[model samples]
Target chain A: MKVTAATFTNLSPEWILLGVVTLLMLIVAFSKDKKQYLAVTVAAIALGFSAMCAFYHMNETNQVMFMGQYLITPLTSFLKFLTCLLMLAGLLYGRDFITSRNMQPGEYAILILFSTLGMLALISSNSLIVFYVALELLSLPLYAMVAMERNSGRASEAAMKYFVMGALASGFILYGISMLYGATGSLNLNEIAQQLQTTAVSHRVIFIFGAVFVVAGLAFKLGVAPFHMWAPDVYHGAPNPVAAIIASGPKVAAFAFFLRFLLDGHNGLVHQWHDLLIVMSVLSIVLGNVIAVVQTNVKRMLAYSSIAHMGFVFLALLADNPIGYRAAMFYVVTYVVMSMGAFALLTLVSKAGAEAETLNDLKGLNERNPWLALMMLLLMFSMAGVPPTVGFFAKLGVLNALVHANMTTLAVVAVLFAVVGAYYYLRVIRTMYFESASNHKPICLNWDERALISINGLMVLYLGIFPAGLMSLCQQFVG
Target chain B: MIQQVIFYLFAALLIFSGVRVVASRNPVHSALFLVLAFVAAAPLWIMAGAEFLGLVLVFVYVGAVMTLFLFVVMMLNLDEVPRSKGFVRYLPFGLIIVGLIVTLMLNVIDPSHFSLHVNAGMIVPQHHSNTKELGLMLFTQYLLPFELAGALLIVAIISAIGLAFRGPRARKVQDPSAQIAVKRNERVRLVNMEAEKKS
Candidate 1:
């Protein structure tokens, strides 16, 4: 194929999303209104348009865009679709919070758009520079969003900690890239792989060092054990909607990038990094579950749960088999749904201008709003990997892949951790059902919040019952 | 010959500043010394033929970022930093670690190992240096990772902004939101304007 700049100019659905976001940002900045309904409407339209574009793109075959740097494969398209969907849900869930705070709705829309752009770039990135740029594009906006609640000292502290640790990780990643470039004299993944095939491993000491550093940098993003110190703080502090986006969308994108860079590009060095990943996964699973048990703060507990979930994803990555990759992708998709639903309920349950941080806040949720309680039940169950919910299928897929890869011990450990994880998730359910309301006020759900929560909750059940279609899509991409 | 002289001079300066950074009693002075060390090291990196790293080290670490660090250090009251007498207990372990690092560095340093001869005959004019080549490579081949680093920088910037802009309470200001949202029209208005004018 004779690649040309014109080939790169073909407007993908992501490009349409970028345009919509930019346009929405401009409108929000310029327009004045007592009610910022226009901003919300525009954001919804843009996200919807992006989702439609992703669907359109999915029908096409894998092809390189932007002169082979950006790829538009089915995998990228699907992940982008999922990211856009989650962003839309988050914006809807956050509408009340944004309005109550009197924050610039345009800024929120633009930041989300920028994050979407980053996620899109991350999924499609074939080159190292593009990948890093995408990662930043996604992350930087998130740091701002974390501190968007300007009056909250907790938010500021969380944003600061996340930012510093993130910077150190970036520095590590850059140093690794430099070392890799120095060793291979090339940056293209295929070219580097070809070069490494001929080069003796012992002769490429810099390459190994670079690989380790790069993986470490990626581990920081994945929030695996030892690199996950910031996750709980950030999650506990960030607004529920922002936390939802952080815990779900960017995480999935990061894992996609990890699969691309580590599993695909540096597949040869699997033996070198697999043990490290194993250690990280094991530690994340054990510590994440154990610590989460003691947390009264619901958000903090979920944050710990996320770390443990990431461990399972890392285990799949360590498996380095096609089934494992597929399972990981499926697991991530389900996780996004579960997290979005859970956080949506969190947003719905809280009163206007207040954050729902504690388990006590969820008390009497079942009596106040049974439907929302039901949604929360499904989400928690999904997260706990219970049967007839998407969470179970997600876990089953991962466990099956691990067992298939002859990782019985790791699978056993994962099963044990899953059992541990169930406790924290179920604690919320218990709080809602078994406990009485501390305050007798019925929780009100907004139209957008209701719609998002219902969809997220139902999707978990729908996917769990019939995971074949999503599994097939994942299998096709990996194949 | 000029390049070698510059490299050695900067290398010595870097080491001197690094030692000073560690030994300086004042935190502000230590920060300044660290900046000096970083600045000196950039020239050494340039001499090692890694122009990209050299320029970035100066531009990012020394010029903008380190200055900001120095400002923050200077702004802070360093009396809060713990001055423990228990440091003597850990001094031996620290020294052992340093000694091990020095031995490792010595073992790795072989003059013959770095003997990849540069093609001096093919040197480009200073006006047409390898900056363009570097930029092309950065944008094209390494585009993903390059962009990811840029995102990390944005993250850093956001973090810094968050840290610097402590809340109104921290800054000893009344809540701006409360003040801004107050309906001033209700509190003050012109009643009987003509009578007021006559008065």
Candidate 2:
């Protein structure tokens, strides 16, 4: 029961992140100076290094660290690696964006690092208490980042809504944990699963009560239907890079969160939760797509599309197999890449004064900047699941998983929603390519920014054509 | 019999204050009533032999969290928050939810679940201090999660600072880094006029 040095080694990734954030915080605090460049460089280098080190730790599997509350397995390592990768990309895109907006890059980078750390812990957590704490650590930064633009009234409003709703979700999760503890006398996920199997039939109802609350709390985090009221507003009101983080990295982490708590803990209660997920998935897909088609704001539209995307990912959960989980992992990784590119482009194109909030902003994009236009076209095409792009394969992979699980009707409905979802993405492309410019000024980006965006965009196409590398990588660890 | 009397005493007041937390018209009153409910409920836990939980609940919830609730409630624009326009309309749904929860609890929770027939868990002597035992387990067995919870607080601090911090504006400011990075030749004259001032 003694804490040992090996415990630190097993938790190397988390320790490195902690060290980086603390160093950044101290440097920022001591100097009455804003060294935006130093902070960003330090964060980028540290995250990049930590992400590379994550591969070494992957060799250790099923080993518990810190009294069985933290586990090191291939799945945890892989998810952590992907999360770190997405976060590094986000920070790279955010650096110039944060500095240009007159926000302190040090605080911004610190919050992002802390949030990533939260997600890392969340994915590897083995206890309900650890999971809740990690979930908060993951979320607290987001609330602040959403309203990081303090001078903006709309940002403040969105921050309030997000905080209140997020706090409520946390409360629900806490209540569920307490209820489960009351029923099973255990907080460890594996122990809870074991205890549930032997629990009397009468007590299973109490377990179900807790299960429902936990599901609702998690659903709120995922921003799926009936619990998605906060997503679009937060996305639209937040700074573009912050919204990009919200939209991409935490989502995959949320899936890992779901998988751990459900499959690892409450697999005994499948009959209790299966139907609830089905309803949530269907509503999310239908409503997310339908609402998106009407949104004129590019960010809001993408927010809705992200919800629908989650609905598809939820289908993988319903499939309840290793292949399905791998498919989900692949789908999520691709979606994250494509979404990050789209939002980073949004960040780049928005002039310091006005935001790219509406469809009209894309008008004459081709005439103004052809390369930017091409990037948007490919990113949008990937989002729409067009062939030769990874989005199609991602969608196809998930659909095949569904069919293999004998979910024909759900698969058919999902395809219908996908078609509906495509309309808005294509609308964005049409505005960019077909329309003429109202104001004749080029969308300007620096060489580095331009290069960064180009690489991200090209990767979408490259990965789509050569999906096996990522797919096999996902399969090696998942399930 | 003494335990029964104490249980009933706390339980009655707890329910009454709990009802007032929702029914009170003023938000401030509701928050205060919530504190009252917490204070009343702690004794019930103590009566049930959960001495550690009782004291901690009082110390943490009533002492810390409710005080915060009062501070925030009093700072708010109470007039802006409508008191009862939608109350009547929402009451039915709220009541139905309460009804369902009570019904479920009644149907599923057996009396035996609350009785003292359950065996003592793990290891604790007849006079074991619950707080000490908890500390031992938490610091040793659950150290990682315990540390994670600490990290969560650090995040909370940063988040509060990020969201709420606005630099003091319209005032002259100095950067220490800029000052420290300055060379002697930059601001100080080569003639060394500063040394001449002593004369």
Question: How does each model score on lDDT?
Answer: 0.79, 0.84
TM-score of each: 0.84, 0.90
What candidate 2 gets wrong by more than 4 Å, as runs, is: A200-202, A266-271, B59-84, B92-124, B169-199
Interface-residue RMSD per candidate? 5.4, 1.7
Give the top-scoring candidate (lDDT): 2
- DockQ of each model vs. true complex: 0.25, 0.51
Clashing pairs in 2: none
What DockQ was computed for model 1? 0.25
**Please, what are the lDDT tens digits per residue for candidate 1 over residues A417-474?**
8898898889899999999987767777777667778888888889889999999999
lDDT of 1 at B7: 77
User: Model 2's DockQ?
Assistant: 0.51
lDDT of 2 by residue, A382-450 (tens): 999999889998889888888988999999999999999999999999998889977668878777778
TM-score of 2: 0.90
